[model samples]
Target: MNKLAWVLVSISFVVGSSAHAQKEIPKAEGYDQCPLGYINTLGTKCVSPIYYEVEPTYGEACESGWMNIGAGYCKKKTILGIF
Candidate 1:
């Protein structure tokens, strides 16, 4: 009987803890709102935008030995030779 009661208590505690953890906290005022493709810095809490090189347009001429992969970018082709 005591073991059954303990099991019930343990299950309830696990469920309650999980529910509490899933709750979202409201953002406080004066907090920086990070833009798209940006992330908040850990220490300073500043917004750091991520940047990437501009990809070439599709159907455009690619450099020699490179082929367009249809994702606005070109990739170098690999040639396999017998060892």
Candidate 2:
């Protein structure tokens, strides 16, 4: 009987401690504890992207690429294959 009661209590506590149960307590007035650490660029709270390096060769320009056909990317006319 005691073992069953203890098991039930533990299960309830585990379920109640889920992420959904987390409520951000406002620190000042219009802000909370930042959810975890920082606010994302999209104004959401959680893990965000970490910049490691730049793009690969035939890199970023303004628009064009092998995929986009023509705009401003690689900037090479032969590479553009428009001739």
Best by lDDT: 1
Reference-based lDDT, residue 59, model 1: 51
lDDT of 1: 0.40
TM-score of each: 0.27, 0.25
Scored against the true structure, residue 21 in model 1 reaches a CA lDDT of: 26
**Per-residue lDDT of candidate 2, residues 20-60 (tens digit):** 32222222223332322223343433221321111112334
The numbered model that scores best in TM-score is 1
- Cα RMSD, each candidate: 19.5, 20.0
Of candidate 2, the 10-residue stretch with the lowest lDDT total is 48-57
Q: Which pairs in model 2 have colliding backbones?
A: 64-72, 64-73
> lDDT of model 2 at residue 35?
27
